[model samples]
Every structure is written in C-alpha cells, then in structure tokens.
Target: MKFALAQINTTTEVADNLEKVRTYTRDAAEAGARFVVFPEATMSAFGSGLRTIAEEHMESWRSALSELAVETGITVVVGEFATTADKVINLLAVYSPSGERSDYAKIHLYDAFGFKESDTVEAGEEPVLFTVDGEDIGLALCYDIRFPKLFAELSRRGARLTVVAASWGAGPRKAEQWEILARARALDSNMFIAALGQADPEVTGVAVPKKGPTGVGHSLVSDPLGKVLNSLDGAERLEIVELDLSAADTAAETVPVLTNAKLGY
Candidate 1:
C-alpha cells in the first residue's frame, strides 16, 4: 500500500486547520497515496495553552474526518482532541475509505515537559488495532512511542504496521531519539513503522506560537528491517512512500522476535 505522511502546522482556528488538512490530503492523493497519516492534533494547535484551543465536540471533529475520507478516498489516520461527556481524550481517529470511523486515545502523556497533559486528557487503557487494505494497522500517538509495552501488545495481536501521529518538540537530540526509538519499536515488533510529526509551531503549543514558522520536522517511514525508506527534512511538507505488508511479514517471520517477546508490560 502507498502511504503519505502529512506534516502540517496547525493553528488556533479549527476550521482553518481542517482546510489545510484537506488540501494536504488532496496533495497526497495526487501523489498516488492510498492512505495518509497526519500529525497529532492535526485539527488543533498543540502546547501549554491548548486547553483554550481544544475542541469540545467530538461530533464536529468526526464530521470533518469523515468528509475528508469521503472526498479523498484515502484512508487517513488523523490526530484530534477527543472530547467525551465525562472527560477529554487525546486521540487518533482512523477514517477508512468507506467512511467508517474508529479511534485510540493517547496512553502516555508528557508531563515532564512542563506540561500537564493528563489533567485535560484521559489516557487510553488498551492497545488498539484496525485493519486497512487487508493489513492490521496499529495506532498510537506521540509520547506513546516511548512505551515499548504498547508496541509489544500490538505486535502480539498481529499488527503488521504501527502508524504514529505526533507533535515532537524541538532539540536535535530529541529528534534523533525519536528516529532511534521508532526504528527500535519496529525492529523489536518486527512490523513496518510510519512516524509522522507536525511542523514546529504546531507542536510548540498556543502559549508558544500559532503558525508562520518552520518546525523541526523529520517525518520518517521505516521498514521492518529498521531501514528508513523515506525521510522529510525540517519543513512543512508531505512525504509519500509505497509499502508491501507481505514483505514486512516475511521479515517478522524470519526474525521471530514477536514469538519470543518476553511480554514485559
């Protein structure tokens, strides 16, 4: 399957961000991508003051995702603030070509970064996976990347590809760490991995910046062998890569790590 990683800079306005997402999805479709993975909080700005910019209605966000899926005819893994009746959930909504909707809330929060994500968002309790084009695709958000247990669980459940949408912050070391960790997860789980991150301002939060600036963008797509097949530099852009789930499955079987995993978490 062909996948496109959308690197967009979201702002305070939800409508504007949705339009940007549409335009990018079209760009991905034009590039012949069958599925597109967007950054976390694809419809809203991220950061310390995010509480003010957060959406209160999951229905509105769901409607936007549904329309985008229908119009583009491309399966999309989008990031959004999931607001429920009881609490808010930072989640990734998976929209299929047939207009079906499903989601996975973020399990890990970045509370150490002078932020209190757990305060506003409820953490998801289970590892979630969805099927697309006959492939079992696991879903996760930013911070969740650090938890190997999540990947192990998804791998055990027969997920062939793990798609992540994130707003990874700046810092060269952190950027490098993101790459290493992503590859590690894929290699250990023996599954194909696609890690998508938003541009800088979209990640820095509302108290930081809105838009009109470059982000420390380093979006990447890796094979089960932990080889980076496609990479986008620091810029707001779209990257498309074609992959074969069968090849990844072959590599996983050859390694057999999933079968021998210790199930630590």
Candidate 2:
C-alpha cells in the first residue's frame, strides 16, 4: 500500500489549516497514495496555554475532517486538539474511505516543553490498532515514542506499521533523540515506523531558539531492520512510500529476532 505522511505547519486559523489538509489529500490521492497521515494538532496549533485548547472543541474539526475523507477516498489519519467533559486531549482521527472513524488520544503528553499537557488533557491508557487494505496498523503521538511497551503491545496485536503523528520542536538534542529512538523502536519491535514532524517558525509565537533547532524537518520512513527507506528535510513535505507488511513476515522468518526476545509476561 502507498502511505503518505504530511508534515505541515498549522496555526490558530482552523479554516486555513483544513484547506491545506484538503490540498494535500488531493495531492496524495493524485499521487496514488492509499493512506495519508497528518501531523499532531494539524488543525490549529494551540499554544502551551490551557485556555487556548479548551476553547477549541472537536465538533467543528470533525466535520471538516469527515468531509475531507469522503472527498478524497483515501484513508486519512489526522491529529487535532479535542475536548471531552473533563479536559482537552491530543487526538488522532482515523477516517476510512467509506467515512468510518476511529480515534486515539495522546497517551503521553510532553510536559518538558514548558507546557503542562497532562494538566489540560486527560491521558489515554489504551493503544489502538486499526486495519487498512488488510494490514493492521498502530497509532501514536509524539511523546509516546519514548515508550516502547506501547509499541510492543501494538505489534503483538498485529500492527506491522506504526504511524507517529507529532509536532516535534526544532532542536539538535531533541532531533537526535527522536531519530535514534525511532530507529531503535523499529529495530527492536521489528516493524516499520512512519514518523512525521512539523517545521521551523512553529505556529506558536515563542520563536524556538536557533540553538535548539525545534525540528530540523527530517521526517523519515524506516524499515524493520532500522534502515532508512526515505526522508525529507526542511519545509512541509508529503512523503509516499510503499508499505509491504508481508515484507516484515519474511524478515522475521529469516532473522527470527522477535521470536527469541521473550518478554516474560
């Protein structure tokens, strides 16, 4: 299957961001992508403030996303800010070609970014594994990458490719952490990893420090062997790569690494 990961910059303008998503969805469809993924909070970049997020609800955002899914005839996974009865949460909306929807909330929040995401958002404890074109896939957010057990559970539940939708800041240390950790997760779990992040001049006006590098925009696709299949650097990108879940079976049959790594549950 052809998969496209969208790394676009989003701000407070929900209409503008939705338009951009539509354009990218059309582009991906024209390019023959069967599935398309968007970055976290693609609708509107609610800054590190709680009031900003609480004010934005999922009702308005879901309508546009559902419309886009029906129009494109492509499986679109979009991340946005959602509010429940209790608090706001980072959410991923997985829409099927027929307009069916499934959601996964951000399980782990990024509290280190001078933002109290957990305080404003209720954390999700369950992991989600959904199907696309007969392939089982996993869903995760940015900070969730730091947790291996979550990915392992999805893998055990038959997820061959885990899509990480994130708004990673630009910074050398953070970028390095993301890169190494992503590849490691792919290698250890023996599954393909599609990680997409946002670009510089973040929607938030905080002005990410030049020294920090918020996100160098090197969105990548890695195989089970920890090999980089394709990548993009600088600016927003829509990368389409062929995801062959059968390949994972073949690799595991030959190496059988996962077979030996017992979890002792």
Candidate 3:
C-alpha cells in the first residue's frame, strides 16, 4: 500500500490549519498515495482553546476533511479536537474517499514530561482500525505509542499497519525516546509502525502556545521487524512511502511475540 506521512506544523487558527491540510492532501494525492496520515493537533495546535474549537468548528473540520478526501480520491487521517460537555477529546479522524468519517479518541494522555493532558482532555476507551483496499490499518494519537498493548491488540485484531500521530514535546532526549518507542512497538506487535509527528515550530517558523506538546519533529516509518524504513528530521515534510503489508506475516513468524503472549493484553 502507498501512503504519505504529512509532517506539517499548525497554529491556533482552524481556518489556517484547514488550508494546510488541503494543500498537503492534494500534494500527496498527486504523488500517487492512496492515503495520507498527519500528526496530532492538526486542527489547531495543542495550546489553543480546544474546547471552543471543538464545539464551534468540529463539524466544519469534518465537513472540509471529508470533502477533501472525496476530491482527492485519498483517505485523510488527521488529528482534531472533539468536544464533550466541558473538556475535549484528542480525536484522530479518518475521512475516506466515500465520504464516510470515523474517529478514534486518544487513549493515552500526555501526563508526563511536566505536562498534564488529563486535566484538559479525557482518555478514550477503545482502539480504532480502518481498512483500505482490504488492508487493515490502526489509528493512535501522540501519547498512545508508549503503550505496547494497544499495538498488540490492534495487530491481534488483524491490523498490519498502524499510524501513530503525534505532537511530541521537545526536551532532552525526548526525540530519542520517541524513535525508540516507535521501533519497540513495531517489534512488540510485529507490524508496521508509522510514527508521524508535528514539525518543530523552530523549523516551521511558527510560534505557538508555549505550554504543551508543541512538537519535536522526527517522523519515522518502521518495518515489521523494527527496521527504520524512512525518517525525517525537524522540518515540514510530506513524503509518499510504499509499504508491503504482507511483511507483517513474515515478522510474526520470525518473532511470534503476539502468538506466545500470555497476559497483559
């Protein structure tokens, strides 16, 4: 399957970010990618008023993304905020070419690294997997990559590829940790892991809220056997990557971790 990893920066403005989404999705479609995956917080960056945005513009975001997907003939999976009564949900929305929209709320909250995401957002209760061309692909948000169980469960549910979208925080060794976690999760689940993150604001030259997981920007694509297929530095990028979905079977035969697992699932 051919997919594109869209590592673009965002701001607190919904209209502005929506324009970026259109441009990148068109470019990816032109590059012959059937689908495009973007980082978390794509609608409005993390530091914005998520509740207000979700309440006021969530439908518009969905409408625009669905139209973009149908127009480009490509699947669009991007992160946007979902509103509740009081707080917001870190939503990973899937907009397919058929005009159907699905979403996965972020299960893991970023309550580490001096940040308390739980204070603002609620955790999701389920995992979401979508199929394209008969191939299963799973969805996750920024902090969800740290948990191996999520990936394993997705693989057990017959997902060969997983996209982990992020707005990873910048700090000492944080980038290294992000890379390591992605590779480990691929190995843990014996499936492909596409860890796409927001481009560093320093690289995008976009000033954002100073108090959350803005970005660290080292997007990566790992094979089923935990090999780094492609990686990006701290910059904005939209690259098409060809994936062999069948490789998951090969890795499962070689590792067999999922088959031999006894607990913690």
RMSD of 3: 0.9
Model 3, runs deviating above 4 Å:
none
For candidate 1, lDDT tens digit of each residue in 12-81?
Answer: 5777878878888889988989888888877676654454456444567678779888988988888888
Candidates sorted on lDDT, descending: 3, 1, 2
**CA RMSD per model (angstroms):** 3.2, 3.1, 0.9
Candidate 1 TM-score, C-alpha based? 0.89
The digit string of per-residue lDDT tens for model 3 on 137-209 reads 9998888999999999999999999999999999999999999999999999999999999999888888878
* Candidate achieving higher TM-score, 2 or 3: 3
TM-score each candidate: 0.89, 0.89, 0.98
Best by TM-score: 3
lDDT of candidates 1 onward, in order? 0.78, 0.77, 0.92
Q: Which stretch of 10 consecutive residues in model 3 shows the poorest summed lDDT?
A: 46-55
Superposed Cα deviation of residue 98, candidate 2 (Å)? 1.0
Q: Please provide, for model 2 over 188-213, each residue's C-alpha lDDT reduced to its tens digit, 9 standing for 90 to 100.
A: 77788888876545433334334321
